[model samples]
Target: MTPKHVQINKQIKLHFALLFVSCILATYLSGPSLSSMPLLQWLLTGLFFAGISVLPLLFFIPTVMAPNARNLSWLGFFLLAYLVWGVVKIFSPNGLIGGLLVCTFILTTFFYTVIWLRPLKKAAKARQQLEQD
Candidate 1:
């Protein structure tokens, strides 16, 4: 693979790992504070959020290290949604840990957005070159 390809893969890997860690942290730290809910209910809610967290990985894993622009674009949208969600939840009474988790989520989303932009630009340039040819 090209260095660009390798770099994108590394970025994706880091972003994915960080996102997963943040999800787990959010689950463990904030899930129990569901306003006097039963323990089982809290656990179930956490597990459900955890499942949602891994949903994007379902797309990335199958794409291998060289996802096309369109696939990455879709993932971009997914991360954007997560970033917005984090921002909206930043003020919730979930404690410092939860706040930090949301910060991590926002950071990872921003990082991935940068990483994905490079390839998208390259793709656009390549298409332009083709059109010129």
Candidate 2:
């Protein structure tokens, strides 16, 4: 892979990690803004909120590092779930900077995935057609 390809691969990983962290932050950071909850309580609340919501991403670590069009497509679909969560969080009570942050990261990640996948897919399609000749 070229340097640019490698850069985007690393970025996809970073984005997922950020999304995971933002899920926790959306809960932990917002609660303090609305209430006088103690640090530990808010922390646990954040952990519980993030538990099942974004954990599936852990399964994609290896695939994302060496992404192919097919695997990236699968991950793209998975990111929709996060987009929904981010949108919901946008208007939900705890929604605040975290909601926006989550949405921002998700979009950036998806954009990069698409940019990476497009050429690979086109090349694959071209190669398949040539093989048929």
Candidate 3:
């Protein structure tokens, strides 16, 4: 496999690992109290959904969309928005450890966004320029 493929695989593994660890940690931290059960359940469910939802978008969407600069730009915008949301949650009074997790999430998302989008953007721009020529 090419280096790009290898990198993508590595990223996928990392994302899964992070998601798993985060969910486990969240559950553990929530404690055994009845009051915490609802919160833990909600958190685990959210994490599960997020992990499942993002995989298809990240790995499959480009296959149909003709990966281009515009698509990448949109992805970047989404990443930025996701990061912002994490930051906002982190700053909220209820977020404590949640804030730290958000920060980590932001960092990971930012890294993957830049890595994946840069090549797509470059290739798209090149394609556009070629068509215009």
Candidate 4:
């Protein structure tokens, strides 16, 4: 494969890794006290629903925004959403534990933002060099 293809693949792999790790960490930190359901069932259901909900935004939003600005704006939106969710959960019947889990999701979002931005910077630099050449 071409270097560009390889780079894109690498970036995609890194993104997936970030998503996976963040999900795991969020689950762990959120607490084990899920509503008496089977663990695999809960995990699969959540993953499926979240993927369905999030994937479209993930795929389309970057194309809508300028490439350099996309990562920052996306991260900001994600962080804000998570914070709002946390606040709502905190005040809801679920209370503090749910709030803490939402906070963990916020932290995970931050980590993903950092990882994503690093590669985005590198990709930008690579593009610049290609333009110069």
Best by lDDT: 2
By TM-score, rank the candidates, best first: 2, 1, 3, 4
Task: List, residue by residue over 53-93, the lDDT tens digit for candidate 2.
Answer: 66787777777777887788988998887789888888878
Return whichever of 3 and 4 wins on TM-score.
3
Candidate 2 to truth, TM: 0.82
Better of 2 and 3 by lDDT: 2
- lDDT (Cα, tens digit) per residue for candidate 3, span 5-69: 45754674465356345534533333244464588686676566556534533553452134344
Q: Stretches of candidate 2 above 4 Å error?
A: 32-38, 128-133
- Give stretches of model 3 more than 4 Å off: 23-79
- TM per model? 0.67, 0.82, 0.52, 0.37
lDDT by residue (1-133, candidate 4, tens digit) is 4565455445544553444445444443343445767888777766665565345336534432333346555654766665665666566563466466555656654554555467667888999999999
- Each prediction's Cα lDDT score? 0.68, 0.80, 0.54, 0.54
The number of the candidate with the highest TM-score is 2
Q: Compute the lDDT of residue 23 as modeled in candidate 4.
A: 40
lDDT, model 3, position 93? 61
